[model samples]
Target: MKWWLIIILSLSIAFLGCEKTDKPTINEDGTKDNGKLESGGKNPKSKTGVWLTDWNDAMKTADVLNRPVFVDFTGSDWCIWCQKLEEEVFGKGEFLEYAKKNLVLLKVDFPRDIEQSEELQKFNEQKMKEYEIEGFPTIVLVNSKGEEIARTGYRPGGAKEYVKHLQELLQPKE
Candidate 1:
């Protein structure tokens, strides 16, 4: 009886130690979220060239700059392809420079373990349905009026090649 009790207690302790933790995911962009109802970004236009998390802000900036909005819908934490897109293209200096000049960048992240506010959550959900996003790493280009111009996903090659592809997509159709 004593041996059985000891085994059970030891197993319980091990199981409790193995339980997952609810720690905040520190993003590459320097924002943190604990995985419920806090906004996912620093603020509206926190950094001039950084990606905006709010759609309205993105559109407003795009209109002011006369630039197209580059909306990246991604599962930032869990999606392999999304991470690849970030590493290969979005994180590169060349893309960042081009984006600052000609694009209002927006990041709509659906993280598996990050917290966002209720309003932000609703807004993201609405846009997800509105844009008919069917997968992770969906890159949608839209005009200042929020009309979708073109949509793309992960493409092979690095930042230069991806930038060239984006330039082609952003070209005005005759």
Candidate 2:
């Protein structure tokens, strides 16, 4: 009886330790939660992920709210670090909530190993030159008049820390 109890307890501990954590559900199309945006992104239920594919579009989005612009330069595919940041940070719920309320998002994608439209490629390259972007997953925060406020990289603290960082960027320069 004692031996059986010890075996059962050991098995239980091992199983618990080895269990995989439940990530937010990835949908059939490889997006999360029916394409819902989580973690410092637009709401999935609302009209979100309205990417400013071009500088003109970015200007337009920036003009509307007159809010500071948050630009994300990423290689959506074939960038392992970008993927890690996306899964660990941007995929969280609280980040999405803060982003939806605070600022405008602009995504500039530079895909290396995949086919893309000429226009998109041109746009990305153009922006890369314009901003002098040197790496993948670089984030730039700019104000309404198109002045750069801050430049950042992927951080591991997820939504809450991002919000704090963004707030600091939004603060008036002392």
Candidate 3:
């Protein structure tokens, strides 16, 4: 009976340890399918409609568009607050619209369970070191020239408030 109980407990633990990870579908044009962003619900494509994982590609696009790059440094598979930010803010249409017009969205994920290519892993680690990321859900805003403009994290008050906060951050300091 004790053996059976232990087996059951082990199985439960194994199941609990398993986590679901969403892998973004890469398009032919090197952009990721925006529908897979772990955004809690079905995520509609932004008006600008592209999310790049590669830093060089995103920076080039930012330069071309004359827009800032909004980098989301997230532990997508493990962090609860990262998930909350995705669900409450990024998934909302308001933030998507604002991001579409003003920002080049780049997702730099540090997932524990999901597999990433070695090159990508190295790149992510290098960027994390460069930016001195200390926690999950660090949102770094960079200018078109690839200079860091601001850094932020998960905030309350949902999409509108988050957008307002980003707008404030993007404002030129006096």
Candidate 4:
């Protein structure tokens, strides 16, 4: 019985000692170790959207994946709500993880207060016209074929709720 108990304990410890699939590590300096951030490290993988400088590049990438594109339109430098979304939503570990999994993130930023590359500015304007964005921080969900599926702005919620919201967006509209 003692031998059996030892075996079980060993197995338990081994399993527990394994690193989580993708949980960010806490660094000794009180910072999260983003570790070769897959998507700019600004947004976690669970949260699928990412900031993109060029819509054409995004479209090409999305085409290859055959996944729907979820775009986050924000004024990264000049908008208070955009800042809040970054801090309260994307900054949260849970939300970032959820985003990385479900959808293909694409960010279209128009920062009026900051100097943006002329090429990037042109791309943002083109996508804004293409998507007909009316406000800051518009989260637009599109189908695999580039068809618009749904749209929303940031709202109060946790990671689970955000996951549910994204899943609902992916569902077929009646």
Q: Which stretches of candidate 2 lie over 4 Å from their true place?
A: 1-50
Local accuracy of candidate 1 as per-residue lDDT tens digits, 118-145: 8888888899999999999999999989
Error of 4 at 82 (Å): 1.2
Worst 10 residues of 3 by lDDT: 38-47
Best-fitting candidate, scored by lDDT = 3
**How well does candidate 4 score on lDDT at residue 55?**
60
Q: For model 2, how does the per-residue alpha-carbon lDDT over 7-123 read when each residue is reduced to its tens digit?
A: 999999999978976456664435565332333443232323344555554555565546667788899898888887777767777666666656677778888787879988887
10 residues in a row with least lDDT, candidate 1: 36-45
lDDT of 3 at 62: 73
What number of clashing residue pairs does each candidate have, in the order they appear?
0, 6, 0, 13
Cα lDDT listed for each candidate: 0.84, 0.71, 0.85, 0.70
RMSD of each: 12.3, 14.2, 14.1, 12.4
The TM-score ranking, best first, is 1, 3, 2, 4
Evaluate model 3: give its lDDT: 0.85
lDDT at residue 101 of model 1 (Cα atoms): 67
Q: What ranges in model 3 sit over 4 Å off?
A: 1-47
Alpha carbon deviation, residue 98, candidate 1 (Å): 0.7
lDDT of 4: 0.70
TM, every model: 0.72, 0.66, 0.72, 0.64
The candidates, ranked best first by lDDT, are 3, 1, 2, 4
Worst 10 residues of 4 by lDDT: 39-48
Clashing residue pairs in candidate 3, if any? none
